[model samples]
Target: MDRNTVEKRVRELNDLLNDYGHAYYVLDRPIVPDSVYDQHMQELLSIEAEHPDLIFPDSPTQRVGGEILAGFSKVVHEFPMLSLSNVFNEEDIRDFDRRVQAGAGHSITYICELKIDGLAVSLKYENGRFIQGSTRGDGTIGEEITANLKTIRAIPLKLTEPITIEVRGEAYMPKKTFMKLNEARDENGEEPFANPRNAAAGSLRQLDPKIAASRNLSVFIYGIGGDGSAYGQDSHSDSLDYLASLGFETNKQSKRCKTIDEVIDFIESWQARRQDLDYEIDGIVIKVDGYEDQEQLGFTAKSPRWATAYKFPAEEVHTKLLDIELSVGRTGVVTPTAILEPVRVAGTTVARASLHNEDLIREKDIRIGDAVIIRKAGDIIPEVVSVLVEQRTGDEMPYHMPDNCPVCDSELIRIEGEVALRCVNPQCPAQMKEALIHFVSRNAMNIEGIGERVVDQLYTSGLVHDVADLYCLTKEQLLSLERMGEKSATNLLTAIEASKANSLEKLLFGLGIRHVGEKAAHILSEEFSTMDEIAKADAEKLTSIHEIGEKVADAVITFFNNEDVLEVLAKLKSYGVNMDYKGRTRQEIPTEGPFAGKTVVLTGKLTILTRNEAKEQIEALGGKVSGSVSKKTDLVIAGEEAGSKLVKAQELGITVWNETELVDALGEKE
Candidate 1:
């Protein structure tokens, strides 16, 4: 559109937005669907970009942001976003009361609220309109993700009162939304999100407002940012009321306390009842209610002394370890898998789980006969907790790695300086089953509504075995399986038909050779450009490739050299499994830079690169990568829903950088 047309369009949008704001805010009614409002706002942005002169002061886009900021400019809090002092047990609460008595010499009141498991965000309102919103980046400074924040319907675009205030709260997704998102992603052949916290953080930082809008995000206002606006109230409880008066979506779960004992009661109640809540809450935040008491308790450079968060125990579940079985992969690595008594853990009913490797098995002392415990550590990944050694049987055997391929009966060998036992057998039946399973996995082949059960059924029924067998399955064959209706069989066949045209890397990943994970497969496919090139590559050349150490190189070389593997490849080729690789290595990567001398801890989900891909990039940039965040970390690439590492980064005041910032830092010559 022309500049004049753009200007005319923006004005019209602004008028419509103002009416919607009035209807939704002061009037307590919404005239448009949230999605429609979001789309209208996006339309204004596209127009304004081409005609900068069309941008107006009162535009809805102006509420979000202008140019992208290099980083957040620091702004001191009108009142500190104080850290809560903790009370681990009842005695600690009594101690807090004793301290309050010594200072106030009178009864003290407290306010308790759910500490939502999400990144803290601060939103500022000026003269009845939303002005600014940002992350709690380093407490004092945060990135201006205003455009994305504006897309969240829960965050009001305008306020009811003609008063300025800053609101502090958690930005999180509901449990229902999290599940829906995961399901949708799985259906679309994308990786499922780890958890709600991760889903929320990822949605909020989206560069495209449309992505943010599609997520259906929400937030809760916890506190008013300062003393001025809370009307005749000098207490924390009153501040929340003031925020509510401004039409913010404040949680009604907060309770006003008459004493520290009452505060403890509220905390304990939530602590017990948190499991029933729809959203994940990591803890409860308790604060001294009065502003006068807050000042008396006042500031440390790092945190305010007024409040503290009481963290919940990690999610734990216990079930019997029926047995430990050895599972041979397509690469013929005999890893131990724990067969449990079919207990539900972390939303999935896990009857079997990976023991990781031989080293981990030995370290955990996990015996087949023991009653084992499992924990979803930090509500994310599930791992074995500990074995109830007292329940062990005298007949329990000490586990050992196999000396020969359990499937192909080939001599097994442990690579130098590694713990896993490898079969290195290309024709191993077990590896073929495992690899074929992985390839047809929902994330890989995206077979609609198909899971391990369906895959196992297909394998058992002899309708499929290797990756290429999927191409040979007939509708008549699929319909013969139990519970497989004609409609479902047709859908499965259609999905399988579509999967034959998947990218070459996916087909490579489906092969599941030892040490060749999805990321590694992608790298190999992109580098070699064809299955023939990869099959022909020598060990030394394979090892020379990035992230392919000697062990992985040996495994890859050994697999390709086997005659059976060549025959399997020929079969796959006949059935049209993609053998043509088409990825270009970003060849201009620097071998030395500031990152070269650094040790970085990557502890969260990267919104773009897969974890292994990020690890490779970090190594290529000349940095050593560590799994956990620590004091020794020179830099940390903080990503969506960063966990303990983010806390550690804050504790040390380490240079915690985001992916975008990390890329920019790499762009620097130094």
Candidate 2:
């Protein structure tokens, strides 16, 4: 085809695909079949490949991921993304309503929306073209994740009108997607993510855009950034409607309440119905309907006075406990699980519940074949609430803690001052599987695509037996596994290879050493620059460090002294796994600049630097930036419309600097 013909066809195809995608994803109406959409997309991709110059940022074909980013850059929001104060019960909601009424000096209207349990992000558009997307980091500054955001089909790449605006939204992974993702992780021998919120956050923050693309994330634009007055929007509800008109996906479940009573009713209605929805909503956000009312109420230091969130109470259900099952963890703890009759709870089927320890089981008087109430602890883990002794059958049996490991048949022992029954066998198969899963988890090695199912397949197939064996895995071997294609195997190999460059803290945490969490791993990495130093250090040397308790020190000492651990360490070292910490070491800030070594708190609005910019600058010059003012605060940077924090700083006799003075101090530091 000629250049002109190709250009014309590409433009036509772009519009066609974009319209179809919008109709399908945003409006939830599929005007075209999957085959039709795929055919056009393939055509667009082919044409784009032929002529790279024809490719545009807003092109429909660009939704698929491209390059891997080194790191996310910081972005300053045009307006602060202030948090909403939480109201748990009816009384708190009434008090908030009363305060709002008093501030406005009139009866007020409110907009109630489902507070989606997901990551808050801001999408910026220039002349109706999507330009940037960032996280709500520190309210003012956020990490730019434009590439990752582009992968979310709900977020439009371009608007219908040529208007410049910034909109705020919650990017979420739907409940179904989260479940499928966990199922995939289970198949791959990886640890399952706790909730949809965490999975969404992790997907958006992935260094590789391809990872985010694979996650099937969605977004709901709530409101525009900065004052809605500029957009000729008079109310928050109107702004939401305006966003919807501009091809942005806004939650349709939102309601405009005439009074606080109506708002309470809305919240109550949603509490039961939220489970019916595909996405998760932790609470209901109530906002003053009118823009003027919002302005009148204004904001406090941390949150806007015009808005509040009413968190839903935990949902519980009753089920029958069938039997007790024991499973060994990475640390060899044989945890008892209550296998229950299948029952619907918290929007999912609950077949098993956590029985923390024998003491708790006895305390609760739980028995097999007894009817027991089950509730999700923190809306994630299922646990037994109470045993219905009255509903218990005569054939119900008393539960007993197992004295030996179920997998290895080794005797289990409870340590002094510990309630957990630990299997002392280091070479237990269950322990090995759990350890491998932990090694490739998000907080550990962060090796993407290696999940629980993959680990099981590898272990059972004799392809891998330890963490070091994972690093030596061939792409051919990965391709031999079920459902692993050439492309996926290549990506997995790349991810595995890249993890070798991670800082020592990741390796430390991935090792599955008892009591060594991410924070503890970081502390250990910072304390000892090399793994050799930590391995050789005595318990006395470990305990000398702050926050390193006797228990932790002994655990560390014991972990390093194990023969299997030493062998694994030697193998890891030989395979070029970095043993030296490459992250920043903890040190005292140098007292050299105007803000040096001082604890500084910022308040109100500023014309020069945003809150995060000021914080970063102060931190750059060795000053510590704190969110709240206290006795320890050496200085408070007060900007226009300074609030309660400014008053508190004055009462504490702390030094206060205006924007101009702060600017001068920054200049002097430079």
CA lDDT of every candidate: 0.72, 0.88
Question: Tens digit of lDDT per residue, candidate 2, span 1-670?
Answer: 8999999998889878888999999998999999999999999999999899999888987788888999999998878899888888999999998899998889999999999999999999999999999999878789999999999999998898987788999999999999999999999999888789889999999999999999999999999886454465668888888899999999999999998899989988988788899999998999998876776676775788999988887688988999998889988888889999998776577899989888888999988999999987756689999999998659999989877889999999999999888998988999999999999997799899989999999998989988999989998899899999999999999999889888999999999888888778888998888899889989888999986898889889999988989999999988888898995455544478788888887777788887669988888788887655656778988888777678767888999999999999899964
Candidate 1, 8-37: lDDT as tens digits? 778889778766764674346899999988
TM-score of each: 0.46, 0.60
Worst 10 residues of 2 by lDDT: 583-592
Error of 2 at 386 (Å): 2.2
| Alpha-carbon RMSD to native, per candidate | 15.7, 10.1
lDDT of 2: 0.88
